[model samples]
Target: MSLGNTLSKYFNNRAETSEKHWDKDLQTHYYKTTKDKGLAKLEEIISGSSEYKINSVSTDHGEISFHVVKGKKAFVIGTVIMVRPYQTAIDFTVTTESALPFDFGYSSKLIKKLYERINKDLPLLDKQN
Candidate 1:
């Protein structure tokens, strides 16, 4: 199965509602979060795959980068952004040519908690919306 499909299945198995199915926005967020939370894993995945090249730099909370592979042909998987604001959360992203997979089944409050853990401050809009 494709990477996207595999992740969709994984999230679906973990979801409790139809509304929680993976979507574009969540996919974007997934890409952003994985890169932020798991760089070494990302690098490991890439390195273990076909020939690849990675370019990265440090950011506020962590690091971000783009991985490219040139083999039978040219292919750009996507970018990664990883963040570890504190001991609380590990945010990351994993973008690809296709949409990444993600779910939004947690309660708004739970999601707020997650945001707060990573961002260090909860936005008022999270409660308003």
Candidate 2:
């Protein structure tokens, strides 16, 4: 193998392996919305983004998974869990696909981008309720 490939393998071996090297990129966001509303908002956000394509959705289980192929490649899986009547939690895992074992923080950036998008619209969603 080439020097770069050898180094990548060595580093990947040392990295966390949960969900196939995506452990560090897994993140959760809490929102003040109902489970149904949270799920709906997630669906709307993913569907509206041309960068993402829906892979599957399980409203019954409060999960929405999608893949984005643009400047940076990633597969995003999210879950909405209700804590109370109007309190909900959203969890996201962003996995970057690359020949190199390290993503150079691309996965984390993806999660932050999603959070920013959702957070920006949260107030409007709350007002409508």
Candidate 3:
């Protein structure tokens, strides 16, 4: 991480995962599972955690909105897309609520942490070997 990116990340209140993010760890992840199964596993992970509270879930839209109740408060939106049968992609958008303009990369770290947990419950499909 360059000083510029580090500074920008710290000074920002949100973090998201997409195919185009410069950070490889921030890239959207694909899993080997059906859309319904993916969403079910994700709901299990989030709802089972005391640190999180699910605000709403739209399985039809493949979207889940939740709030972080542990440590600093934040709002998060998780998306699950079915690119093909048994191939699903997942992404996250997190916005931390803080008195300061930034949460010192809290949002970014949260995405990574959530990804780790999700990967454990689901088979991650890496784009590259």
Candidate 4:
């Protein structure tokens, strides 16, 4: 094969591989950023608010106290599991670990679609560039 043709073929293969790597990296970064933003937004909404009161907060793990202190610091003081049955055999379980009250921000489909949209080289199976 001519040198020009060989070089062209080599460059094309490298570009395809590099493009795949970039797409994967971008997706991972997007997820990380989205998760962080969602958590931050949840914190912003709940913390330093009267809605999440200390006395009224009851969970299956335990009761918690929301302490608002020193400018913008808010801390939750309580157990993770609270059971309040009111003398009944039925148990009200408040396990914060399993309970995610915050938004996850991006759906998997959305993220995938986003990755496709921003990626300069996609549909690698039909790659011509």
Over 13-41, each residue of candidate 1 has an lDDT whose tens digit, in order, gives 12211213343223222222333344444
RMSD list, candidates in order: 12.6, 7.9, 1.5, 22.1
Those runs of model 3 whose alpha carbons end farther than 4 Å from true positions after fitting are none
Per-residue C-alpha lDDT of model 4 across residues 83-117, encoded as one tens digit per residue: 12111111111112113332131222233432353
lDDT per residue (tens digit) for residues 4-100 in model 2:
7445533531222132333333335567888899899999999998999999999999999898877867778888888777777777766777777
| TM-score winner | 3
lDDT (Cα, tens digit) per residue for candidate 3, span 5-98 = 7787778999999987878879999999999999989999999999999999999999999999989999999999999888899999999998
Candidate 2 vs. true structure, TM-score? 0.74
When summed lDDT is taken over every stretch of 10 residues in candidate 3, the lowest stretch is: 120-129
Q: What is the lDDT of residue 101 in candidate 2?
A: 72
Q: Which residue pairs clash in candidate 3? A: none
List residue ranges in candidate 1 displaced over 4 A. 1-37, 57-60, 71-129
In model 2, pairs of residues that clash are none
Per-model C-alpha lDDT, please? 0.34, 0.70, 0.92, 0.29
Candidate 2 wrongly placed segments (more than 4 Å): 1-27, 123-129
Scored by lDDT, model 4 comes in at 0.29
How far residue 127's Cα lies from its native spot in candidate 1, in Å, is 17
Candidate numbers sorted by lDDT from highest down: 3, 2, 1, 4
Better of 2 and 4 by TM-score: 2
Prediction 3 global C-alpha lDDT: 0.92
TM-score of each: 0.28, 0.74, 0.94, 0.18
